[model samples]
Target: MSTRSTDPPPIRSRIDRALIRGAAGATAVLLLTSCATLSSGNGERDNVPEDVSTDITDEPVELTLAYTDDPPSTELVEGFTEQHPNVSIELQQTPFTDYVKTVTLSMSSDEAPDIAQYNPGAMRSLIPSGHVMDLEPYVEAYGWEESFPEATLEPLRADEDATRFGTGSLYAVPGALSVLGVFYNRELLARAGVEEPPATFEEFEDALAAVDEEGIAPFSVGGLEVGGFQVWNTLLNAFGDHEAYRDWVHGAPGSTIETDEAMTATGILTRWVEAGYIPESANATSDDDAKAAFGNGESAFLMIGNWAAFEMEEALGEDVGFFLLPGEDPDQVPMTSGSSVSYTVSSGTEHPDVAAAFLDYLSSPEAARIQLDTGFMPVDTDASTGEGGVLEEINSVYGTAAEQDGIVPFPDFATPGMIDQLTPGVQGLIAGSTDEETFLSDLQAEWDRVHG
Candidate 1:
């Protein structure tokens, strides 16, 4: 049950900034260049199938699926194929790093898979070239709005120009979900005299200080990678306005990350670094190393996504627990950075309905079990994740955020080059080389480069 051995897939780990940086920039250029002709091309293909059916035909149908994530993607396909004995799904999996670079091209080719994994960056061009089908038709045909959480569907949507997101045509459906939150070592918390998970932001800080006083490292941060900015991401979700952040990430006109709440969140992270809650050595630590350190009882808390649950649960057993980074107002609606392992049908597919059926199966009760067992939150948030465990805890917290439509895109999704700024900027914060103002300003500058 150890999800980690020596190497892990990027989907199960932090986003690899280097892998996607150049590829994303190239994809953005495609989006920009295509904007002039995308409208005409968008109308050329009838994205909607004339006959939409949720039911698959009994006639033997062969479909190919391209994906990168294994546990859920492979197992989910098997689950779907099992239910429809007459249908065969061939899975094409590429490594996460290579997938980002190659998927866009593959998706636009003449022989694209019937179904392909959804990548926001890939969609920038795939969507405009009329290679990717807009899933709005499937969404209505299958009643996905009732099955999958709206929050999970938001990022999969984008304008025809592929500039703004969280609105316009639906492009994909989530098979499994992940959310950002705090993972704590129970014994360490108790040793620090904290009896329960903090219910408010104020209580959380006090607990961190208490753990510090108890001579326990307050946080095991992957400051060397996505772990660094994720601390600020969760804090911003706690303190900042969700809509504002969403708008900024989706590239709303004149949207800016240089807000008062953003400043406060950045400042709070700076204060935590100064307080020695986050170690300076974190700048050199990989996410895997940091998680291992936490598993070894080196830190009281680690803020990360639920993708770490299976590994953490196997390592710590009942000694670990999870909770969202609590908000300043106890009554505030829960909001968090959440993303999904989603799949989309190719626009050129002859069996669009059959391909759509595979997506529909993702929200079924059966797939929910596979999704949870694979260390991902099920798209069907209402589906039971069984009795108590860190997995259940994650499902519980994620369901609350989903119900209120509070799960938003990770900050890295703001732009192609944003993670480049985030990881290094946060390293500066942790290293005391970057001020909060500079960090926020740098982020805004990157945002302007793409979104301006």
Candidate 2:
């Protein structure tokens, strides 16, 4: 979640410059292929079996994978190789900042990896290029619809144009899942005389006031990066209409973010900034800095995804706890933005059956254990994560949402350059340089630019 550039230059300066370059490069490519549809590898049918096979030949097979996320990807690969001794997987790791660009280029080459971590930005181009396999046949064969959560799979589905989502062919399957929530310092809350995690947004606000009164920074926010919009995103999930938000994020026709619910969510964020619940220095902070501040006990709360769980637990141990951002009403169905460290097979792979079997392994009970141990929500939502702790707390809350189909795609996924818009828009909001109307308008404008 940090995503702070290692360059000596400012984070915003670097990100903005990168976005401009990326957008221009993408635009040139898009124009050249605007008339194209998702290709299925020159109409040559794959040699994969129609039914999911339980046993693969004992003959040795080798695969190469390109990925960014570590814990899950590395461990998942280890788990897969352990099960099938005859298969060997080689990994090519890239930094998160360079991953999209690097993976996209490599995947387009004739020597593409057998499997690569799925990135929506790259997939927009890769899908239409016929380089990535459409996993519909495998999905049905493996009964992945029953194995993986529906919400997780929905975002990976796209039309032939690779424009609209939630329908058409599937592109990938999740190796591990994650959810967004609030990570709080248990000692800080107790010090402020708050007994437990707030079950409603009203109570959460009150806790913020109490903590502020106790001379503590209520929330640690990294307004300089994705951290800022992540806060706005959490609030929007709690306050907005889930289906409408989902439709907009998935590029459904006629979807819009300029709703009364979105206005209410934005107002709540602005009010928090004004109330000093979110500090003025937040705009200058990096996500790593914010997480450090919270872990060091300088702040009471940090809003982020489960990906931060390992570091927080390492830094704070039992002092930290997690809970979903509570909704406006206590009885409201819980919702949050979540995604997976998913992988896709290359159409160029010589061992299609071996590659598909590796994917199928992701849903197995053994892989679920590896997923939980690596601090990610398992693909099997019903998989047990053991007794009480921050992970248990996360699993309990995340399971409820997944069962109710409340996990929605993140807002930035709506468009390729949307993060550039969301990050800066939230930065302006915190700085009082942009009004609520302008912020919402900018978000909707970006959506229109991409989906129109």
Candidate 3:
């Protein structure tokens, strides 16, 4: 990827310092020092865009990596290994149900892999903490601009501090372009006399009601941990206060995650669950299990990311069809959170240039297509197409979103620890342990706890 303009002031100084450090080192400690100098750059290259560590020599050059169960992770990693034989990857995968916990905890330790899947919100945390090596200069010097997308690349930059390497520099890479869709079994929908996907929330409720008549779970949700919360958050991002979503994320002005809009949207889910549109046992379903239920046809509609495509295709064998989740904001871009599961040279990598080169290779669309078909739209806009044909299909269905300017970041992207609080609070709301007003109160209360 490449850029035309200079980085923001805060970011520019960080870049100068990194450049001053001179040639990258073969020893990990020296390389890390250079990387720490520039945390933020390419702030405007918004949406711009893997792993393998083959060696276990006492040299300790491994790039440890982690991911939740997404199909492409395995596929892409395998493919990446084929091209670069020396880079060995240590895989740590969690079920989609347990992914958040696995990812959240691993990120806090120095033992965190040299490269692990990380979200945009965490970039600020990791870079400021010096847990991740800044990729801004490598991105610029290597002209990552030629391959990476500006819109996709921008979110991962944290440019707030010059010495801290907090903002405006590249710390993570977007793993995939994740879009929200209502995955349905066409056979089941046809049986319900709903031949087509509904284009509005009112119609969606009607369909769920029809499905509930047969005693099937109408929608799937992982009630445990954050799985239960994503269902509500996806809706909130798709239809609620988006600016507020960002404000809450950036600690900006007038954050309204507690706004009536957010509450109303969440209330709708609680209403659905109470009305039997969702199963009472849903709170116990793991995220992967919940998504699996949809594949099993135990649920009629699964509000899921494109990553679920391969699972559906594998389980049902041509039984699945998908459409965007219709929401109150018809004018809004369909909800999606584009991610770059980034690769970074570890503060401890022994071969920084080789590690950086390997990371650069992993960022390519070629490497992305190999991952277990993450179903993310390639952040490399000009790059050739990939075999993960699922991404191509998602792009076709949701391409209309591009016209909306930018897809909103997932509610999970709004802030770290936000969803850890949100999921349980929302689950309690749906389960009747908390009312909507109280749900809102608990949510903000949790934010205060985490932010404190």
TM-score of each: 0.90, 0.88, 0.71
Candidate 1: tens digits of C-alpha lDDT, residues 76-114: 777667667677999898876677667888887778898
Worst 10 residues of 2 by lDDT: 6-15
Give one digit per residue, the lDDT tens place, for model 3 in 117-218: 654444544455555666665676567755555555555666543221213677666544555666787778777777777777778778887777766667
lDDT for 108 (candidate 1): 78
Candidate 2 ranges beyond 4 A from true positions: 1-54
Q: Which ranges of candidate 3 are over 4 A from the true structure?
A: 1-116, 119-126, 129-131, 160-167, 210-217, 329-331, 347-350, 372-377, 381-392, 398-405, 449-452
lDDT (Cα, tens digit) per residue for candidate 2, span 1-452: 11212111111111122322333222111111111122345775332233334346567889999988776777777767766667899999998889788888998887989899888878778778777878877777678899998988998887767788777888889888888899999999999999899999989998999999999899999888777888999999899998998889778988999999999999999999999888899899998898889889999999998777777887899999999998878998899988888888887777666787788888877777777777788899888866568888888889899999889888878887788888999999999999999999999999999897
Ranking by TM-score: 1, 2, 3
Candidate 1 vs candidate 3: the lDDT winner is 1
Between the candidate structures 2 and 3, which one is better when assessed by lDDT? 2
Query: Going through the candidates in order, what is the number of backbone clashes in each?
Result: 0, 0, 58
